[model samples]
Target chain A: MTALLVSVIAAATPLLLAALGALLVEKVAVLNLGVEGMMLMGAIAGFAVAHSTGNLPLALLAAIAAGMALALLFAVLTLTLQANQTASGLALTIFGRGFSALVGAGYVGIAAPTLPRIAIPGLSDLPFVGPVLFGHDPLVYFALALVGAVAWFLYRTHAGLILRAIGDQHDAAHVLGYKVVRIRYAVVLFGGAMAGLAGAYMSLSYTPLWTQDMIAGRGWVALALVTFAAWRPFWVMIGAWLFGGIMYLALYMQALGVPVPTALLSALPYLGTIFVLVLISRDARRIRLHRPAMLGRPFSAGG
Target chain B: MLSLSPRGTASEFWRYAAPLLALALTALITGAIFAFMGRPPLLTVTTFLVTPLLAPGGWEALLVKAAPLVLMAVGLSIAYRANVWNIGAEGQYTLGALAAGGLALALPDAPGWAIYPALMLAGLLGGVAYASLVAWLRTSFNANEILTSLMLAYVAQYLLVYLVTGPWRDPDGFGFPQTALFSDAASGPRLVEGSNLHLGLIIAPLIALAAWLVLNRSVLGFQFRVFGQAPRAARFAGFNENRLIWLAMAISGGLAGLAGMFEVTGTQGQLTINLGPGYGFTAIIVGFLGRLNPLGVVPAGLLLALTYLGGDAAQMNLGLSSAITGIFQGILLFCLLGSDVLITHRLRWRVRA
Candidate 1:
């Protein structure tokens, strides 16, 4: 049980980070499907940098920058040029995969230094919960803190309100003098940074090894989680944990001789994601309860 | 100097020229990539793009590879035209192969002529059945077909892995993740004795012809196109959105399944894990690159197949990594997308006051 908790937290960290980033982007009315590509690039960049410099912080920063760079490309095409968001997002994924492979070709099968764990004094000593919650690496704590920070920003701050208003109705926000394009730019870049950080965590902390296609559709899951969470930061956390828990459960069940087919077990988490999407989508009201009106639609300032 | 204007005749040419222009740009970018890897750019380009077509059996390989892509793309074009995104052709393809493989396994001793037709039917039915899940979910519960289809693909992959690793493991062979080598009767008969090209290549063109007929000549095609262009207009015209959704998905699924059936019988000759190397996904690009035209898919499919062949050649001869191919493919798509910008809006040079 304790082991299961640790595993779930570990799995959830990447998703949590990516979801928070996606939540921010969606909050700004930009649905960037490039998260998968951004994360993959981050994974490769982070791993390559960490392996070379032997400095974890610098590697992570580089990864975040790499992710942001990729996100900027997406912003240029989709946000500035007003390209189709869905097609551009798919293009980014393809670009990232190819670019990462091309750039990181020489670095395949290489390993990176594992992130050092940071233990909270009193909390770390508490039996099972402490080790699972308090006893963890810096990135895991950062992921949790991000959820709180994002929630506070979105619901508490004036800037958050402006961002939400823009997402709700871009033209209306434009008429009201809310620098809609600029705010979107900031939010999209912020989202990119977080997604990059998540990808960095996958390599430097979670797996501590680099492989081709290492992100392995986690970005898509993050996208789905944002929808599953109904675009709320708190629910995003729950959704991440739920997905992580499903993943851990599948692995645990296999270890426990559950007699489930290995293939089914492997696909369980994806199945859970799909099933959750169906459940949430069935309630049209629930699905539309918090959607930004202009999500997935490009905004042209004067047009 | 000609004054740059936002609206110009040249701009229109540039817009339509984007796809072709993107291909040129991709070539330049890939040439640099080859140089960076210490390979001769000219030699690498030839091997990556031209050499694949010049090899002795190149035409045959191209036809074989083009078969599934043309079929899948033609079907997907229908859904795409109707604004239905079915990203799960990979899953449908897997299911089709499984069905066809199952049928082949069941009738190991069947006559050659009867076996192939039965396999093709099983493959078609398999695809339709898997696709119906997406249709049912979308119509009954309003689920997003994109997510459902994608998730189903993973399930289908898992199913393939389980079967190949477990019950389907060949008894006579060494323990490997592959089924028994199918008999000649179960395999797709070659159109040419010395090449892998099979009846599926012929089938692909026929499928394209039928797709063209349906898309251009049929009322259903008109409805689908209308629904795609304007959903509200379609509804006003008394077109059923639900029925259109089913039709789009069914055709897409059936074509993808056919691709898989041909792959198993014609090329691999046995069911195995990793049967598809993202062909279904890549075909999405092919579908768009071909402008969703069934006839256009022939060239688009062959072009993509060339990439696979060239990628392999680069890996062997130039010592370039296999990923260089993906990089080239990515660049092509990116350039194409970037070029498409000209289609809707003109780039004008404006003077700052």
Candidate 2:
């Protein structure tokens, strides 16, 4: 049971990180559907860098750089050029997938370096919960720390207020000299870096291997999680765990001699996402609980 | 600081020319990609751009490929025109195939004439039913159709995998992820002897013509155009947004189903795990590339179809990955989207002091 719990937490870490990044982007009113593509690029980039240089931190930095680069392209097309967000986002996913395949062609089947777990001296000695939480690698703890930092930054900081104001009303924020575009660009890049970190976690720590199309729609789930949590940092964590729990149930159910087809069970998480989305949509007032008013709308100065 | 200075009509020509220009740019970029892969760029380009249509059965393959694209794009154009982004057509297409395949499998010994029409009808109904889920969600609960349609696609895909690997598995065949080869009774009639082209090819153009008439001549078509262009005006004009949404989704869904049915009956001759080759998704590109004009969709579909044939040719000849097709499709759509900037806005040079 403890082993199962540890595995579930490991699976949920990448999702939690990605969802947090998406939450930040949503707070600034940019709907990026290319998270899957960005994550794939990060996975490949992180794996390649780590395999070549044998430096874990550098590989992570490279992954974040690669992710930021992709997000910059997205910013150019959607923010500056004013292209359709949906189409551009999908294009980015397709582009990233193809590009990663091309770059990772030679690296197929190569084993990735395992990240060492940083065990807490006191907490790691706990009987059941220790191994599941405190005995995990540095990335798991980093993800948890990020959730707290983001929650604080979003609610307790002046910059967070301005960013929130922009999301709520870009024109109003612009009139008040808040530099809407610059703030948006910064937030979008930050989101991309976090997404990249999530991807790196997949290649470096979690799976510790490389595969084609490995990120496989996890980014889409993160996108859904943002809405599932109604854009709150704490709820984003809950949403990720809930999704992770559903995934664990699928694995556990199969292990318990259930006759359900594995493919159907594998699809349980996505089905649960659809159900959650329906529940959220059913309550229109709840959707606006933490949603930025200007979400999904392109901002133009003096419009 | 730069300010908005709209370029004139002559400059707008360059905007519409952007897609063509972008295509040229993509060719140049991909040519470099080929060169990097230790292959002759010109040779790879020729294989990718021209060699596919040169083969003996190439034209037929192109037509077969274009048939479903045209059908789905035409239907999608209706929904897109109404500003209803139904990305779940792929799922609708799959469900249509499932429905038609199920019907064909149930009546194995039925006469060909009786079974074919029934299969087609079943396919159409399947698509409409699947599409109605999106429509109902959007109108009934105000759920974002984009995510709902997209998420449902995975469910539909998994359902296909389950059925083919489970109940629909061919009894006589060795362990494989496919259903029984469809009988002659279930297959669509061939349009030409010794060719894969079927009645779907003939039916596609007629559907396009009907769609064109609906959009151009019918009042409902006018409502769709107005709704898409300006929703507030549509509402102020007393247009029933709910009715329009339902009608557009149903039409798109039904046509997508027909595309799936034709694909199963005309080409594959069996329901398999790979039934949807992203045709439903690609049709979105085709719909926009054709400028959402039903008549224009034919040439666009054929053009995109050429890329599929060409990509296969390049893969076989150049020893490249089949994913090259996806790359080319991505580049094409990206270029088209980038060039479409000229349709409404133009780039201007600002003198920096």
The whole-model lDDT of each prediction reads: 0.85, 0.85
Off by over 4 Å in 2: B1-4, B7-16
Looking only at chain B, model 1 earns a TM-score of 0.94
**Listing candidates in order, what is each one's chain A TM-score?**
0.97, 0.96
Worst 10 residues of 2 chain B by lDDT: B1-10
lDDT of 1 by residue, A156-261 (tens): 9998888999999899999998888778888888888988889999988887777788887789889989988999999999999999999889988999889887
Give TM per candidate.
0.95, 0.94
TM-score of 1: 0.95
Per-residue lDDT of candidate 2, residues B133-165 (tens digit)? 888988888777878888888888889999999
lDDT of 1 by residue, B110-164 (tens): 9889999999988988998999899988887788887788789888999999998
Candidate 2 lDDT tens digits, A1-303: 888878888888889988899899989998888888889889989999999999898999989998888888788777766677777777777777877776787788988676789999999999887888898888899998988999999899998888899999999999998888888888888878888888899889887887887886788888888988899998888888888888789888989869999779877887888888888888888897778998878876646
Clashing pairs in 2: none
* Candidate 1 segments whose C-alpha is farther than 4 A from its true place: B1-16
